[model samples]
Structures are given as structure tokens and as C-alpha cells.
Target: MAILSSLRRRSAAISVAAVAGAATVGVCLTVGSASAGTVSGSLYRDPSSAVVRWVAANPGDSRAAVIRDKIASQPQARWFANFNISTAQSEAAAYVGAANAAQQIPVLSVYQITNRDCGGASAGGAPDLNQYQTWVSNFARGLGSQTVLIILETDSLALLTCLNSSEINARNQAISTATRTIKAANPNAKVYLDAGHSTWNSAGETANRLRAAGVQYADGFFSNVSNYNSTSNEANFGRAVISALNGMGLTGKRQVIDTSRNGGASGDWCGDDNTDRRIGMYPTTNTGDNNIDAYLWVKPPGEADGCRYTAGSFQPDLAFSLANGAPNPPNTTPPTTTPPTTTPPTTTPPTTTPPTTTPPTTTPPTTTPPTTPPNTTPPAGDGCYASVAVNQWAGGFTANVTVTAGKSDINGWTVTIALPSGTSVTGTWNAQASGTSGNVQFTNLSYNGRILGRQSTTFGFQGTGTGPGVTATCVG
Candidate 1:
């Protein structure tokens, strides 16, 4: 049960056609991978990730050749789980079944947290907590008996500040139940709670949150998810979190790191315009750290963060830059075939449905091996753990409040923040705000009514308030 590596799949306009009676399912999305890193075991086939697909579509593009050779052909993870239970179940089962046929361990990204992405780039998930529970159960059915890498709910823990109390409670309950269920369904399944990135949450807070989310029952935790935090930095951060967990009597737990986009560190993680980024450590299980298990590419390099291009689709230039400028090159080289097939697979290419947020579009695939599939991180926290940012301009000022669900979710919740006298709310997002000055009752919108455990969400408005020291207090 030693999984020494991880994966990061790319998104695109692609098709994953399931081959009836075949050993594997076809995924249409084309993604690229790192050109450097260690490999504990063979990677699953990814004929459809962004890099591969782009190369296929424009074979004559000279700049893409190096990336085409180094990354597009490399294997990555296949993400699963979405709004529909039946869809998640079928997709997961199909991908797992294909991996079993290839004898390659598959990496699964379970990312359908209710109100996922907290009304951001990757938004929209199961309608409610109950629907999410049912969806997770159905997703577990896909694991079968094979060893699978399940990165549970990316950003679920780190984004706790986005939720209110009731949502937090429900989120914790959801994680505990999902972990137990996935393990029960497949004893060989290795589950890892998403730990966001080092820049986001402190090690102590991350460990505490994971514990509350039932990390004790998981294989371990994962860090630098799709982020550009350097591997060394992430390792240090990960070790701290692991040590904190050990202090809590949670020992023998190991963690996997995503070295996909951390070629160089970034000062602004939320800034989608970052390009100093490069590919990081190759996927391998032999990472030097004892507490740190493996090094993986949980976030494919070329996939946009919804800033430059469509959020998850592939960008050739970015992929090329990452592949070409890799600080440490991979030990192995991929094949030079039209659709690189370093290791020919037996199962057919499986067509897949993109995550619910956006639809995928692709033409066709030459051929792909049946292999296992794939694919967030957390943000920073302050002492109060709950605060808001305000902007004051001349005659008017704007206020935004982020309410944390200290220990539980805010179900059918209401949030109230104090406003200065003579203050009036002009607008807001993801919430409803009313009342004036001292008592502004901000109710939940239908889409974000329920917050996940340890998560938080914000609502803001414009109003006339005293300048500078116009302090505000928020409560959920």
C-alpha cells in the first residue's frame, strides 16, 4: 500500500467515450505533466490532458514540440465527483475499472463539496449537504477493491473561512462520513484530505482542521494542491503540520506534495496573472522526508486558474514554459509518437464529462492506454480567524464581512455585522444584507445558504460611514 506519487489532470474541450466491455473508460480532456520528478510506480495514461490535445490539434507549432515531448505525453490524475450521484458513481467506477485493467494505480480527485469554490472560479456543487452525502456514497462505489489515491474535497478545509457556523458543522459531518464510507467501500483506497498551500493556513491550524475533518482515518494529507509554492517550502510546511498532528497523538500519518507548478514561489497566490511559475519536482514516492510520503503534480501546469483563460482549460504557452524551464528535468523521457504512448495500454480511451462548472470540447483521440485517473489548497488565517476588509471613499464606504464557522457549519444560517450609524448597504454578493448602521442582518443566498465545516464566505456592501476608524464587528 505504498503510493509514492500523485497526479494533476488538465481540462479541455474533450470527449471520453466509454468502450463497452473494455477494461477502461475513455477521458476526452487533454492534460500535460511535469518533465522532472521521481516515480515510485508507473503513471496512468492521459491521452487527453490539455498539453497532449493542443499538440495534437496543432502539430506544426514549433514551441509546443518540447512541451509536447516532455509533458503532454506524461501521465496525470483524472478528477471525479460532481453534482449528480449517478454521474459521479459511473465516472469513478469507469476510471477505476480502467486503472485496474492497466495494473496502474489511479489517482482520484474528489471535489464536489457543496457550494464548492465558495462562489468563485470553480463554483457549483451538490445542492445541499444531504445530496452531497449521497453523491459521495455513490462515488465510493467506484473504488472497487483496488488501491486508489483519493484527494478528498480540494480546498474543503482551507476554505473554511468562507462559511458560517451551520455550514461548518455540516461540512465536518460530511467529511467524517465520506472518509468512513470510502474506506469501507474499498479497504485499499488511500484518502488524503486537501491541506491547501503553505502560504494559506498555518501548520497548527491545518492539523487541527484536518483532525476535525477526520484525517485520522485517512492515508494522510496533501499540500500545494495546484499551487506554485516551492516543494521545499511545502515540505517544511507539511512537516510542521505533520508534527502538529503527531503531537495530537496522530502518528504514522504521511503526506503527499504537489510539485506540479512550484518551479518558483509566488508572493501573490490569489493573483491569477502569475507567470514566473514553472513545473516542479517529478512525481515520485522517494521524497527525502520521512513524514512526507510522495511528491506529485496534483495541479497540472498549463491549466489556467480562471484568470488568463478559461479557469481549467490548457494554455500552450504556459505549458511550454513549464516544460522547457523545469529546474530539475525528469529522469525518464516520453515517446515521440503522434500521441505519445511510452507504455502501450490495453484498455480503450474513456470519454469523460468535465467537472460541472464548465463543459469540455475536443475532437478525437488517436489512441490511449487504459490507466488510472486524477486531481486545491488552503488560505492564511489570523488570530480572530474572522475579519473583513473595508474601503472608504469620500462620501461613501464599502464593507465586507467574512464569518467563520468556528467549529460547525451555518445551516439555514444568518450573519449580522455591525455598521456605523448613517451607514446604508448599496449592494452585495453571495448573501442578502438589510437594516442600517448598528444592525445589518446579512442572510444567506439560496446558492450559498449552507457553509461547510471550518469554512468561511464573505458578503459586502457600499455605505456612508465615518472614515478610517469606522470599525465593524461581524457575527454568524
Candidate 2:
């Protein structure tokens, strides 16, 4: 993303190249100052996280220094939205109570969509709308007038395509009900809804989905949650969504973008390797663009995005990479009016024949163990690799894939896998794809588009896997 600086500001211009991942951003770096850690007016230091607990227990390990200095030392979020029926109320009360005691506003992640994750890695939510309301009621009771920033759901709108009309209606009802419940409990709470990212849906499409899901009751929308899309890309994408919302007669809408791990935007959404990841603009209210409330660490650094380790496990080494690699704001920003890149069939370099003898560069290793145990093993593969499966049901299954560079760094990859006579791509995560001409063409998301030599990234689809056999063809 490019930061527009007044040419009069010499320091910002010199600092432009100072950003850790400046080269990876499409818009050049040029930003004003910003604050670090949690948002200002916070009641207290961040609640102790898994990393904090680990540091307290494993103080002697070499990584403990970095963990303590970087990951454990900062203020990040505490997710109270996971499926923990027995503890939901108490946990919610405890978190808010702690923030209350410290006199700080709290930040919470509330994933309350009835069917939550679409049967993907982070799946499960309240069984139905009634139960969801009960759960949200318990959650909201804890906020009681304290200032807070609430991210209602990470992918609430994206689920529209996977559900039938009845299911969609139910989901929207659940969202609207939950929004009212939260607001009724604490009218001062700043609530935001999900808009996926610049790459996931068009502006009008996202605005329509947000409206359906009850944007009227929200502070605004948020984008790039738990993904690595560029800040500029997300900023422009967010503005577009906001404009669309306003065009529909909604006014004074605002947005928030996740800056936790976007320091570098290689578009590596599905890859576990994050050495290239950089720190983004710190959480602050002084965002140059008034439409943006703040640039936040929505997905805490060091937390694995499923592919790297167990989904959401906090990795210390990765955390250290994030802390050490991020540039202090004066950071980067993208244009508000920029349009999103079009998704379409595109040309990529040809794949080559491999001898049974020669080995390709190894995919980069994921970081050390996280607070939660991590599965650091990368999917074993060669240059430009692919893998597929037909195991969901009689007509459905999940497709897990991998792509590694040949002899040098790669900017993009295209993997075309032939489907059986009746199979088609129904949904995807960590990347984008289309099913046509009897095959599925999957490509990288913007932040994960470029990969270093030997480093790899992955993407997948959920669709009709009708074949008795499946094969992959890749180009990088």
C-alpha cells in the first residue's frame, strides 16, 4: 500500500523505506505517526495470553526472551466467542470485570454466527438461533457500559453462498438478534461486523451482505481479519464497501482493518511460513483517514492461521518475527478510492517435468511450538505441487493443496486440477478459485501471492469431489 505524505514532511519520506515489508506493498510506504500496543483509553494491559502463561512456565528457553520482549509484552485480544457453553457467561464476566477493574475499554472477538465456520477448520457455533441468543445474552451481560470494540464475527457474510435461503435467513436473524442484545446490554460498545476482505467480495456485494446481517445496529464493518491482505488493499476495499453501504442510504459508517500481521503483504493467505510478515500500523484513533477508526491487531501476532500449526495456536518464533519485523508507525496506507484487482483466468509460467532423482527446494519451516501445541510439519512436496481429495460425502469433499517455488522466489501460482465428470468447486478458504471447463483453477490471495525461494503456501476448496482418482497440474 502507498502512504500519501505531504512532500514537505522529510522524515516520513525517508522513513517510507524503513518499513520492514515496504517492497511487498503495492502502495509505497508514506505515513504519519501512530501509537503502539492496545487502543488508547484501554483500561489496562492486555489480559494474560497463552504466550504469557508459557513464558511464566518456560522462562529458561532461549525463545522466552523474544516471547517476553515481543509477543507476551504487548496488548492484544481475548476471544470469548469460542464454543464453551458451560463457561461462556463466567468467562465473559471475568474478562469485562478485569477490564473494568483496570478502567480500560476491552476488545473482544465474538464469533456468533449459528453455523460459525462452514465446517472448515474453526467450525461450530450455537446449534440454532434460539441457543445463539441465549449464548449472546450471557456474553453481553458482562459489558455493562464499559467502552469496548466488538468484532462480531470473522466470516459471517461469507457463509451466504454455502447456505440455502432458510439457513441464510436464520443466520441473519441470529446476527441481528445478537447485535441488539449486545447493544441493549451496553449502548456505548463500538460494534463492527465482518466484510471478509478486499479480495473476497465486491463492494456492493459486501455492503448488501452486511446490511442483510444487520449493519444498522453496528458501528461499521471490518476487513482482512485473520488473513494477510495488504493494508492498502483492505483500506480501499473497506472504503468501497462503505461507499456501497452509504449508497444504499446508510450514513456515517466507518471501518476497522486488521493490522496484526500485514506488515508485509506477500498475499500468502494459505501458507504457514510468515517470516515475510511485518508489523502494521499500531492500534490508534488518529488514523489519517477518518473513515477508518483504527488499524488493529485483530488476529494477534504469533497465532497460527491453521496452516502453520493448529489453527489459532500462538507461536513464539512467529510472534518474535512479527514484533521484530514490524516498523513503527509512521506506517503505510493504501488509497481510499483504489479499485480491487479483478479475479479472472490469467497466464502463469509453465510447469516442468521432474526426474525421479532431483529434489526441489524445501518448503520453509513453520515456527517453534506455540502456547498450544503446534503441528510444524509442512506438507512434503516439490516445486509447484498440488494435492486433492474426494472425501466429504457421496458428492462433496475437501481439497487441500500446496505450492513451492522451483529455483527462485515466486510471485504467483496457478493450480488446475481436473475433476471427475460431475464435480465442481462449491467453496474455498485461504485462497480464491473457480470451477469451469471441467476443472477448478485455484490461485493465491493478494497477501500470499509472492513466496520466497523454497518457501511455500497452500490453498483449498470444498466441492463435489466425484472422482475415484484426482490429479494436480501446477504453474508458478
Candidate 3:
């Protein structure tokens, strides 16, 4: 079995020369920057992932190059599937702390529902709902106020067919309580409930189930976890579910789709040792679709699904096959226009004093076409507006700036922000930026520049210091 091969290589010490050469050549040859189409480069990549450890242990392996470039480098959710009630808090703290230190959003998957997997191959969870509730609270204690994305309990809602009516009610109530508990513990954590995949349930039925499981309290629902469904199908199904939720007076619910392992066939195949499957769109929050919040890898690509290996175990052969089968990486050509060339103001800023200039390295903007065309009609008032929402920690902060087209569509836009003193912008995603200190400028990338009338698009940045008095303005 592939697991045996992996275990054999686990203790081997790889030399420095092998690591450097593979890192350079493999990444350049196989994968480009995660900026085009569905992949966003902003999410956090776990340095010590299963695939990473595998690649490190077996640098000389034939399949190491492709797996290193493709699977190990990408950001995917880290699942907390064990029932470690006593150690949950510390474990959560260590993971979330690493992400916070790197100033990137962490994607966490909580899979300890009462009857996980319906006593199938991937069985065992909290003993009961009450214990599960306590486990959730303990886990939530470690999610400290940073921007985090939580995928709650895969198969919890969709696999309810096996449960009795009373059991179903109990599960839903537990989910509801867990949602509230996590949110209350860390307001910045974006919780998403599972809604199976596109082919599993009708859109209306899925929405009904989601609501019954307290979708009202969550940021949104996620679909296609550990399943091989196309992004388009899942996205369409998500919109239909949102429509159903809207009909139930549960408006403004967004959705995320798991693009992992869905790049190939969109069938009901699960736990099958199939080599035809491919990795889906790279994880990204800047999906260009308004209804879809992100395309995430809730299920890491290299891990087996209870077939060909033990469930949740990393298999290098499977990882290599999936990477080999993926479509060519998206073209990452820069937009025709250059980064903002406008000169910074020579005089003192109005809102806050300037800080030491530490400009972030510039990255070429992607040329992927926008998913939604801008409204051509002129607006009644201003062409666009911009707003800023900030989350701060001890010495750093992250801000999400939203640009809204007013009344009509906008062909392009430039947003300027006056950040508070002592703050310097360090990194950004979904948009190109110029000027790192007080009064920074952000311009729309080729794919996200155009927006429909009254619709909004978001871009975010990380900064070194607090930016409480930040103000932003948009010009279209």
C-alpha cells in the first residue's frame, strides 16, 4: 500500500540541496501564483501539512516534485476530527495562534458531531450532544478574535436520513448551540454549516435542513465537502438554496463551495480508489461571484477517503495522481495597466500622521476576466462608494475594504484610504496596492475592477499597527 511506502520514507533525513532545487524548479514548473480565476493568494498555508511532511521526508521520491508544488503549497482547512475534550482548547489555540502570527485567515474544520459518518468507516465522535456542546465551547476558547473560517461538522446535516425524528431534532439543536457558542467566543470567526453536495439534496430541501440546523446564526453554508462535484453545479445549487432561504425570510445568507477533488468528474463517487479525479479551483475568497463567498479546499487533496488507505491518512501516490490529473494552471498574465502611478501627497495627511515607509513587495495583477459585467448605465449620484471594516490585535490589524458601484456599473475604480498614525500596510489581496504608510492607494485588478450596479466587491490588507480611525473613499 502507498501508506507503507510513505511510512518507510518518514524518518529519512533529506539534504539541503535537494530541498532548494525541488522548491525552486517544482513550483516554477507546475504551479504559478494563486492569483488567477478562483484561487486567492491571501489565505494561510499550513507549513507542517501532511503533504509537506511527506515531501520533506521523501525529497528523492519520484512523485515528490508535483506533490510539493501542487498539494503542499496550497491552503486547505485543518480538520479537528478527534474527540479530545481535555486538549481541544490548547490545540485550537496553537493552530489559530500560528495563523494570527502570520497575519492570514485560518480555515478550520470541526468534525466532532455526536454520530459522525453514521457509524461508517469514519465513525466515532463526542459521546453525546451535551459532551459535544462542551467540546465546542472548549475549542471556541482558542479562536482568539482573529479572522477565521470554521467549517462545522461535515455530514451532520446531510446524513440525517439515518437518524430518527427525535435524534434529528437533538442534532439540529446541538448544531444551533454550537454555532452561537463559537460566534460568541470569537466574533471574527466565520462559521459555515455543511449542506452536502449539489447532487445529494434538492436546493429547497437543503435550505430547509440548513435552517432547521440554525443557518440563521451562521455566516453561511458550505457544500461539497469530501465529495467530487463541479464548482458550477455546487455554486448554482448554493444560489438556489440562498433563494430558498430568502423565501423563508432568511435573507443575506452567503455560501462557500469546496472545490477540492472536484476538478474532474462530478459524480456520487466517494471512498473510491479512482485516479480520474483532479483538484478543483485553488482556495480563494475573491471568487468574483457575489453569491459565492469563497472556493475552499475543505478536504485536503492528498488524504484518502477510507479507500485504498485508512481514512484521513496521506497517500503520496493518490496525491501525485490528483496533481498529475489537474487542468493546466490558470494563465497569470498581468493586466495591461500598471500598478497605481499616482504620486503620494507631499503635505501632511488630514486624519493621521505618517509612519515609517515600509512598502510591501509588488505583485503583478492577474488578467483573468471579470465574472460579472459592469452596468453600463450612468449613476444618478456618485459613481461609487467605499467602506472600511477593521479588525485589530495587539500590534497588527486587518481591514476589509468594500467598493460599491452606485446605481450603475463601473468600468474601473481607485480607492484611497487614510489610516491612523503608527499603522503601515504590509500585505494585500484581491487588489493591487501602492503606498504602505498613512494614506495608501488601492486599485482594482483586471478581474475585479468591474462590478454591477449597487453591488459591492471586497479587498483586504494587513497592517503593522492599529488603524482605528481609517477612512476610505472610492472614485470610479
lDDT of 2 at 228: 64
Report the C-alpha lDDT of model 1 over 1-476, residue by residue, as the tens digit: 11111222112222223222212121222122322222244556555444555666565677666775556655566665346666777777877887788676677777777876565555666777656766887888878997777878777776654676445545754676688779989998888897766766667777767765667778789887745667888888888988888887777677888877777664344214556667777665556567666666666667655545655556677677667866434544333443433332221111111222221121111111111111011223321123454433345544445555545555655655656566666555456767665666777677655666676554445555542132333344
Residue 361 displacement in candidate 3 (angstroms) = 56
Best of the two (1, 3) by TM-score = 1
- Per-candidate Cα lDDT values, in order, are 0.58, 0.57, 0.66
Model 1: lDDT equals 0.58
Ranking by TM-score: 1, 3, 2
Q: How would you encode candidate 3's per-residue C-alpha lDDT over 1-476 as one tens digit per residue?
A: 01111111000001111111112222211122343232243577665555655676676899987786667667777777667789889888988997888677788888788776666544567887656877898999999998788998876776654575446645765786789789999988889997877765667777767876777779889988745678998889998989988887677788888887777863324423667788888777777787777788777776655435554556788888789856544433311211112221111100101111221122111111112222233335758877665544456555656688888789899988887788898777667889998788899988678888897666667677775343567899
> Of 1 and 2, which scores higher on TM-score?
1
Give the clash count for each candidate.
Answer: 64, 18, 1
TM-score of 1: 0.62
The lDDT of model 2 is 0.57
Candidate 2 lDDT at 325 equals 44
TM-score, prediction 2: 0.59
Reference-based lDDT, residue 58, model 3: 77
Q: After superposition, how far is residue 104 of candidate 1 from its true place, in Å?
A: 1.4
